[model samples]
Target: MTILVTGATGTVGRHVVRHLLDHGRRVRALTRHPARAALPAGVEVAEGDLTSAAGLEAAFDGVTAAHLITFGGDYRPLDNGPRIVELAERAGVRRVTVLGGWREGTLEPALRASRLEWTFLQPVQFMANALTDWAGPLRATGRVREPYGDRKSPPIDEHDIGAVAATVLTRDGHAGRSYHLTGPEVLTARAMVAILAEATGRDLRFDELTPDQVRREWVAEGRRPDLSLFRAFSEVDGAGQADLVEMLLRLYGTPNELATTVTGDVERVTGRPPRTFAQWAADHAHHFQP
Candidate 1:
């Protein structure tokens, strides 16, 4: 079976491609830039944009199952969901797995209204956020500054997210289901930093900032927020920087059941326990190295 993977070069999408290859399935990767995608050999790389499905006919042709992402460029939610779903239906694709974020996009509704079998993979947070948000601070100053140091959540590894997606796409009984994926254990920002310190052998410190302090820091950084807040507010129009920062602070500071919930769905689907933060940190320690 040839499986088409959109967002093929993204954090979770890359892992989906690799695990699908490991499953001995023929993989077709969709990317806006095939040259830059650099996916594994033997996989068909198709160049197309998810935002505009005008020229995507060839990409969807002859694909049995596919993986999709809700957001397009700059982390914005895709507004052209109906057209994409129509294209998939026309191509006779049977199954679809969508890697979605906190908020549902236009694609979810379109997928629900379609005849295709669909599953949603909702991860609470990604462990890679350490690399995205804290790596520079850890490398430069040996300190990671953020709010809600004690707010706990079980962040999933992107690799596991990919594995689950592949399993759902390739296997049956996952249709019309949504899985909340997470790591094996709960951890706070400070706890994650401690694990990173042990893994990278660096003198790392987690500095807890007040809500106002966090807002000021984001504004001082020219309001280019990190992945955590950026993805949350990507769909909000004309939202001021302070509004974005406050919303993030509220999200992190509050007690969220979804964020703190750990599920066995990863092991249930992949037949293996999810990787721990320490394991993830150890595997990616070089990214934290000076």
Candidate 2:
């Protein structure tokens, strides 16, 4: 079966493509820059924009299932989501796996309304997001500073997210399911800083800052960002950040205060255990240090 994968170059999507290729499935990867796509041999690369369905016809042709990332481009899911689903349905695509973020958005609801077999993969926060956590400051000054040094989350590995997506895309029984993919541990920012310090053998400090301070730093980085998303970090409503620690602990299989879950779910699906945070840090330590 030919599977169409959008966001084929993204952190999670890239792993999906590689795993699909490894499984001997026909993959038609969708990207705006086909030439730049370093897809595996035998995978077909289709140049298209998810924002405009006009270029997607050839990509969806003869595809049986698909994987999609919500932020196609320009973040206009209202305009592009339904069209993409409509085209997939018309092309006789039976199953779709949507990789989603935690925030409320148009794409999630739209996919819920579609007639196709759809599975939503909602990861709390990516382990990769922690790149922003320590990479820059470590490079500049060997310090990772942010607010909520004690606030913990079940930050997942992107490859695990891809493994879940591949399972949903390639198999049955996953339709209408929304998997809250997360790491096997709830790690605080301070704890993570220590992990990095041990991994890199460098003295790393986790500096806590106020919400306003984070906003100012982010603004100074480049263009202005949506403050609500950043503010959501500090605004620990019961349903949001406050619940994250509990949710992650539940997903990761940790109890008490220190025992972390080390499940084989990733290996079960993709023939590998999910990479640990320390392993991730070690591999990416250069990115964190310099």
**lDDT of the candidates, in the order given:** 0.89, 0.71
The TM-score values for the models, in the order shown, are: 0.96, 0.79
Q: Which model scores highest in TM-score?
A: 1
Question: Clash pairs of candidate 2?
Answer: 184-252, 267-272
Error (Å) of candidate 1 at residue 278 is: 0.4
Among all windows of ten consecutive residues in candidate 1, which has the lowest summed lDDT? 223-232
Query: Which lDDT tens digits does candidate 2 get at residues 1-290?
Result: 99999999877889899878877899999999988988778888999987777778888999999998776444333346777878888899999988774344566677788889998876666777667545766877887655567766666788788877887788777788766666777777688888989888888888876655644554444423332234333323444433433343343333333223334445554555566677777877777766
lDDT of 1 by residue, 1-290 (tens): 89999999988899999999999999999998887878898999998989998667899999989999999876778889999999999999999999996567799999999999999999988998888888887888888778889999999999999999999998999999999999999998899999999999988999988877776778766645355666668568887777777777788888988779999999999999999999999999998888
For model 1, what is the alpha-carbon lDDT of residue 269?
Answer: 96
Candidate 1 is scored at a TM of 0.96
Worst 10 residues of 2 by lDDT: 251-260
